[model samples]
Target: MIKKLKLIDSKFNIENKVGMLTFCRNDIRNALTGSCIINDIINTVEYINKNNTVSVLIITGEGKVFSSGGNIKEMLKKNTSFSGPVEEVEKKYRYGIQQIPLYMEKIEIPTIAAINGPAVGAGFDLACMCDFRIMSNNAFLAESFIDLGIIPGDGGAFFLQRLIGYQKAAELTLTGRKVSASEALELGLILKKVDPNQLLQEAKKFANEIAKKPKNTIRYTKRLLKMGAKLPLKEFLDFCALLQGISHNHKEHKSALKNIKRKM
Candidate 1:
């Protein structure tokens, strides 16, 4: 059975084996640092990983902004996550907002970012963490941390470079420029762009497509893809062979074979 998640700053629902998490703190523009969004995200990812019934996850914001990243007001006041000494700040980061990326990386299911509006700083990094990004044509993304005299304290550099290569990632990071959705598609940063009204529908459609696949195979394939990025070719193939053996022995594999034979 799939477990119900108690998210403090977000809303979650499941349908057709696809779980959707919407950032609900539009009052603060879904800022990660000041609000409970980081905890919500980490918790949601953890829940999805353990829930075998869920095959894909779609994340988006509820209002005009996807996420404004950190709360600038809190930063100026040196309150909340931005408060305290250098050591204190480091500890906050290590245990607080930084947990999102760590948990996201370990998720076994496929993830999609439905960028409903501007995704700035850590917000952009959040989208980059997903396996796929479907953005609204009216929305934009920015690596705006440079403007604040800070860097991506949430592992943005690591994911961005892998998504769009180092040169493009460096240009965006150093310049802190806003990238339109169309431009993001051209740069290979986002998979597709749709009208604002169609963003969630399109994202759900994409999610459902992946969700329709054989359950265990989807998780295993996602794991293999992540391993492929860093594992040596021989090691990857060895792992793949092991998974293939397990997959072939599963009942789903037999059912799939029977279906194929019937069609033939």
Candidate 2:
């Protein structure tokens, strides 16, 4: 049995094999920096990877704003994670908020970002790190690092381009423009768009759909999808065969087959 997760800046819960993580720092618009949100997110991701009972994760903010990215107050004050010399700041990036993308990449379960409000700078990148994104009609996204005279130091460039292609990603990143839900849907950046009140409900509905599948099969399929993006065709197929062999012998597979025979 898995113990409950303790998070300082977020709320985490699991229901029906679906995990939901909500950013609780609404005061600073759920800023990634200058708060415990980063650790909360990384810890949650790590926990989910070890928790076989969870097959899907849904991330969102508790309040109106999903996340405002880095804390502007901290940036201006040059304190917290944004403090110190140039090299020190680089180290902070390596050891700090950058961990979100790195950890998120390794998660075995499917992740969905329920964008209830604006997700700017690293917040937008955070959403991109998820496998799927569902946005509220009133919400928006922005690659606003450029406007702050900084670049996407948290792997935003890597994930965003993969989501919407390099050209469009470049345009958004360079311009530092806010993308409306409609425009984001048109660009295929978001999988679905709904009213604000329905955002979480929609995300849960989708997450539950994935969670109800054979647990190990869901994880293996997610792994295959992740590998397919980087691995060569031959190597990918080889890995697939290995997993398939194991899957065929699992009790879940036998039960499924029996059910199919009954239906027939």
Candidate 3:
């Protein structure tokens, strides 16, 4: 079922194997408007989670940029000056935009962000939502929230600090600097960078490899990581101990144990 969210034009391309969800408006570098697209992302992800068919999701951009962040012009038109504009957009952003990343954060299936080009602002937050990221060499990540005289929303502070480390994430967010693909990979902000022409191919290859892993194990691992930020270490250890026991009894674990015995 093509979940209806207007800003996104779903192709249903590559179907159950992997869903290639791209931003449809490339004219403005596929920037997200504060409307249906964000809701669409939430709807699409939830739909995928319920469907047994879609094993992985590959999210990419349209023409040049992944997303130029949230719609700046829309925000500007709402309020011409300082804190007023911030409050005007903030309510819409929090309600309409944040859910996309939140859904992504809790998603069971592995998500691959194919950074076809530069991603800034909320776009950067969107990229950070993915389980793995494969970027184009031309792709850059910008923390533009500060430049706009606003703090990073759409999960900027939450994900960046985790990705690169507190001090580094602080510097980037505080400075509103644009980090290159090479620098991002080096800092552990991203997994790898591919040439622009090869970006999608690399993402698919990575997704396919993940798709081959035992599904429940992957889901459990992702769940644990999601809990990482929220749980105390002792509690986390207890949770993992229980989860690992469940995993051990799973058939894939049993099969792997059998294979190991045969090798011995």
Clashes of each: 0, 0, 0
Candidate 3 per-residue lDDT over residues 8-48, each given as its tens digit = 54334554367778877676667766334565677777777
Ten contiguous residues minimizing lDDT sum, candidate 3: 3-12
Give the CA lDDT, 0 to 100, for residue 2 in model 1. Answer: 61
Ranking by TM-score: 2, 1, 3
Instruction: Please provide, for model 2 over 76-107, each residue's C-alpha lDDT reduced to its tens digit, 9 standing for 90 to 100.
Output: 88467888999999999999998999999989
The TM-scores, one per candidate, come to 0.97, 0.98, 0.85
- Measured with C-alpha atoms, the lDDT of residue 71 in candidate 3 is 73
Candidate 1 C-alpha lDDT tens digits along 1-264? 666799999999999999999999999998887888998988888888788888999999989999999999989884578889999999999999889899999999999999999999999999999999999999999999999999999999999999999999999999999999989999999999999999999999999988999999999999999999989999999999999999999998999999999999
RMSD, candidate 3, Å: 3.3
Off by over 4 Å in 3: 1-7, 10-12, 79-90, 254-264
RMSD to native for every prediction?
1.1, 1.0, 3.3
The TM-score measured for candidate 2 stands at 0.98
Residue 60 of model 2 has an lDDT of: 97
Clashing pairs in 3: none
Q: After superposition, how far is residue 204 of candidate 3 from its true place, in Å?
A: 0.7
